[model samples]
Target: MDAMTSKGKPSPRSSVRPLSNEQVARLGERHNLVDVTRYYPNGPRMPDAPEIGAQNPRATARLLEGVSIVMRQRSRVKAWGYDRVPTNGPFIVACTHVAMYDVFIPMMSIFHQGRRPRFMAKAEMATWPLIGRWFQLVGMQPVERGSGKALAIESESIRILASGRPLTLWPEGTLTRDPQKWPMSLKPGVGIIALEASRRLGREVPLHCSATWGAASINQWWPWPRRNVVSCFDDRLPYGDLLKDMGAWGDEPPKELVDELVRRVHLRLVALLAEIRGEEPPAEGYWDFRTMTRKPWPQDFDWRIGSSALATETPTDGVIGESGVDPGLNMVDKGAQS
Candidate 1:
């Protein structure tokens, strides 16, 4: 609870920076922008441009407003877990990307915990009119996702961590289309980052993996939406001297060592899912003919089945739903504590 307030102050640090929801919304509506990014000031600059990104006062507020809109218009999501997040220090955060709004849980949680979450986004997202400018202003480093660009990302991550700012990343690369896909797989980019940070900083950066359950699914929208909950789990991967104890070079090898660290994170997430449901495992592949129109699975687990690709072809939009006016994600409904 003793997190330094210096990091918690809203970006832009001025009331006149035009980072408000109303202003951003008006700009987005008129410009047809769906996403925005802000880059934080890397060095001193004029007061007019002042700072961007992390300093972009309106980014978080506007995003929160948008999230609230989705909650009201779409399904409900009962959220939980600000108590578990840390208030300070530079750590590497790994979260399971289950939905598009997954980014918000960490961001909002940190907001409540009095810390700002710094995340990495794709470089191309910078091209979006209003959205890109926001990200560029927020001090978020852009990484090209793929093998060829891996070094660039690894190097940037090392620098970010060295600067003593915690980094939050969705190690899964992409959202699992089916949460039932238990620990199916993940890319090792996270490992690469950890390896580099350890070698450069002479310390193991704390790595925490998180998961969210019942976050409003694909069709969930704004105004009065369905409830969603996010439960997070954390563990540490000692990088500093742990690497020497295990005898590894740089951060990339022994592949087995890195694999185990990654797997442990996955296992922690799997346990969280099982614990939340009080079940053996998710019915991820539990496709049903009745749900031929969608990726079917009930809110409460029952109709048992396993590992079967649906024989029936369902249209993607079959389950598409319109959101009502619920201000969805905006309400941090710390429903019954899990």
Candidate 2:
């Protein structure tokens, strides 16, 4: 157990802790504990999972078109790259979750860019009455929570990837609501699925980061709207190279590849968020989340993305690997918009 003695402030360490084996057993029990099956016995107790979201290209494309009409008339918001996302693919769209709106606007942008996005929603989210149904309609699926849930998510994600469709997942697991003030951390296990899929498909899966800024809340889509910008990079960072450049844990130079992949995503996320904010990112020592899977940084190791380093223009020459050719351009088929 670790403890900080200097302050009365709440520890940045999550209060959510490791579950005991007994707790795990209890969790399994509670999974179907109050079986509503007795009353509705014929069907599922919770609502059906959604399939229309980031997964259903046709629906997302249609939805984004409508959002574009609304955004067109709005003066405070700016959108970039409604032209780069692929219309169909086995790709991963990594996004930053700051505000609740962090999701919708980006989805709208990607939809306009020509790819559909499927995202993981909390299991509780699926149980909501009307809103739950909407999530399913939009391709949102319930992600069973807890450490044990990782395998379940991984299994489902591989199946999703195999379908040759795109899926959006938060490595952060949830939003980085106050990332600037504190360390923005992400769960490291996310890389496992990315790597497995690449190995199974015998190709590096496509990974891209879309960072957002200046949006207030997710629900404030109406009114004049807050000044916001959605930036998409055509970076084709590979599942393996991402881990390599980002520095994941390794033993024989390739075995801990999953650790390496997660590490890379964390590193890139730091860069992406820093670029979006146009500010110096928190120091490496302060990035507790990234350090979760690797060695802690020395005090002088800088990780901040400074204003001097922010890309004034998107990188035309984006990341690449053994993949035949990198699609590192701001050009997705406009037919994707339809």
Best-matching candidate per lDDT: 2
Query: Candidate 1 lDDT, tens digit per residue, 1-338?
Result: 01101111111212212123343333334333211111111111111111113345466456544555554344333333333344345677777655556665555444433335568766676787876776665556775665466667667777888776768786665554332433334456677677657556665566666655444333332323334343443334333334665334743556765665665555555554444333565444331212222242434323222111121122232211111223232322222100
User: What TM-score should be assigned to candidate 2?
Assistant: 0.62
| Model 2 misplacement above 4 A | 1-75, 177-183, 216-225, 239-255, 287-338
RMSD over all Cα atoms, model 2: 15.4
Candidate 1 residue 147 Cα shift, in angstroms, is 4.4
lDDT scores in order: 0.46, 0.49
Error of 2 at 78 (Å): 2.5
Q: For model 2, what is the error of residue 246's alpha carbon versus the real structure, in angstroms, after optimal superposition?
A: 19
- Per residue, candidate 2 scores C-alpha lDDT tens digits across 1-338 of 01111112222323212222343234334332121101111121221113223355455444455555655454234343333444455777666655555566666555433345567766777788855655676677678776457667777877788777677876666655333432255565457667666656656667666665544321343535433343434354554443333333332124366565665566666565554444565434333442332335444334553111322333333322212213443443434333
Task: Give the best candidate by TM-score.
Answer: 2
Q: TM-score of the candidate numbered 1?
A: 0.58
